[model samples]
Target: MTSNTILQNATETTISGDAQVINAGRDVNMVHGPPAGLSQLLRPVSNATYTRSGPVAKCDPGTRVEVINMIRNWLNRRDKQSVCWLNGPAGYGKSALSQTIAERYANKGRLLGSFFFLRGAGDRSHIARLIPTLAHQISISVPVTKRLIGRALEEDCTMLDSSASIVHQFQRLIANPLSSPLNLFSFFAKSKILVIDGLDECDDKVQMAEFIEMLIDMSQRDQLPCRIFLTSRVEEHIRKKFGDARAQSVLYCIDLAAFDARPDIQLYFEQEFGHIYDQNLPIMRRIPQPWPSSQALSVLLDKAGSSFMFAATLVRLVGEDSMPSKVLQEVLDSGSNGLDPLYKQVLSSASPTPAFHRVIGTIMILLTNQSIESLSLLLDIQAGEIVFELLKVQSIVKIPGDDNKPIMLYHTSLRDFLTTKS
Candidate 1:
């Protein structure tokens, strides 16, 4: 399916109000109720879902069509080449494409679950929540697997303990349940898949290694019966893991950077500039209809460098408290490395202090993630004071939507600048 079709009709699955189906069973070993804290351990992490076209944003029209079709075709096919990976560097829109495809299949009732990883966002950024989250969703969607999964959890509550191996948890809590008599024969025959994006952003290197190895073994051996659509940067660790010569035959791969990004990016510039002209008619009353000059468009496109995040950051810079013409002029004057100047603009506008520096440093360098409250404890400050400092640089740092959410860098480049641009 085209990306346009996916965006218009797709909806993500949520567990907020899903009714728990509890039934008594024949086997004495199988317990009915989940163990006291097992459900929490298995609970899906918050803010893991990415909306296709809501507040979070979606792919612009005419973007990622080819990639979308390629993935859909693979998902529809039934074969032992069971894993399709869309790999690329940061800012190339891998996560956006993943969300669009997820919405498409989810609207068609084929998506088992999707996990989006944000670096330094705690559980959302690790393999810790991967198995339980997938198991919970599949049980809810497939229903029959629920009883089997409950029994597995009841048998040994330590299945999800930190000390237990990733392979062990996945085998008992996830693979075994789905492959049980409940749904084995039909699984390989079906056209469904699980969507996992941002694998490289996951923090635990050892766990990630075991996670990928176990997944490869299961698919090749037919131990588990679902297809996986995964996206990540070709980080050295991930690249090495997938490079195992024996598994190469079963892994399908795509590198997004090699494709021509000019056409889609050009269209995005046109639409956004037109919106700016309409929205600020009073300030832009005399601006031309296709507001930006061709010369300016050429310059901006040159700096976009085929990276979607670069294009997006430039658009925001133009629209924010500055005239389009003046911003475009500044952009044209900047050298090939235009993002550096733009980064400086954002930092100067924020007017940082020592405390703000400390808060932002923690946000950028965190090993996993922590919410504002937890950060306060770690930083030895009042909880309310954290957001107060974060507000100064809200443009670059995303304050969470709730009390439970962690602060995050809006783009990977922001982290890049903070850590290396001394």
Candidate 2:
């Protein structure tokens, strides 16, 4: 049973003297359980854009080594600049870099918590659960944190209530426990990292601003033990909010776009292109190893426009199509126009079947994910048929481990490509 279910039934058992007989294990868990409101706020890790402990197969390698080094420099120093923003556009490798850092510190025991705020991935989209989730994680990770956090919640259980302000929740749920003398593990020799990625994805402008303010307040004080590392697009809301003296005092900013992506981008094309050649050689013998000629690769690099998404999108398209040269030629001729035509080419090349067209269109416009069975049911088609259609575009759409998991987009640009009227 869920912690909430067990607690609810336990409450009823006291009044009615009978509910379903409670399990001992569940009862024990409930004693340490967060309030029902906080429990409901838990977004499954699968909802995060990057699920694994590290970067996945198609993800470009770690070219942001300097960015990671900069973060370390900040962490090692006694400076009060607790918050660092790795700001960049949609297609830059900010999320990937964030994932790498979280995994690195977490394994070393210096990671207090990691929260990835994905766009359109349910509760993962907002700051509602941010503090509570961090609280629960840190409390469990560092044993002494339990007394500090547990006492706070026990004293004021309404802290997690919907009416509670964001600052209030952070002050109690995050700031209180962190500021205390945490029980030390041998691995925790340094300040821990609290990684919050994709801040721009959270739609609540007001709550977001309040959360930043709270971070600024904590940075000035000796309380909170961990340094905050956040990644987001430089949205105007964040720009205006962080413009304050307090925000500026504690904030360290890094622009991912400022770095050279060419070397990394080149490595990405060479590797993925080689993978496609090896995998699809039997289907089409014409494509050669190191498939795109050196000249053509140069052409691609010039037009990639310093965006990893540009490279990623084209690679996905090439993976799906047997004729990589045709796609390469199209890309070469498209000139400096950017990703518009390449997207159009992919969409226009959709299967002639109406079902396939419908599936692609729906996936493009649908902000969030749905299961294969759910999509089939929603589209009034068989599950097998939906899978078949999705397989045709395996490069762009990511199928989950099972039918129960939602189908996710490989990149958000596909949505922009399909939804816009170009």
**How does candidate 1 fare on TM-score?**
0.83
Cα lDDT tens digits, model 1, 270-372, are 9987877777778888776566777778777887867777777777767664476676666778785546666776677667878778887887787765789
The C-alpha TM-scores of every prediction are 0.83, 0.82
lDDT score at residue 228, model 1, on the 0-100 scale: 85
Off by more than 4 A, model 1: 1-38, 51-57, 338-341, 353-358, 368-392, 401-404
CA-lDDT, candidates in order: 0.73, 0.71
List runs of model 2 lying over 4 Å from the truth. Answer: 1-62, 182-190, 282-290, 364-367, 420-422
Q: Which prediction has the highest lDDT against the true structure? A: 1
Please, what are the lDDT tens digits per residue for candidate 2 over residues 244-332? 86677778888888888788889888888888778877754666545788988888888786777778878888877767667767778
Worst 10-residue lDDT window, candidate 2: 13-22
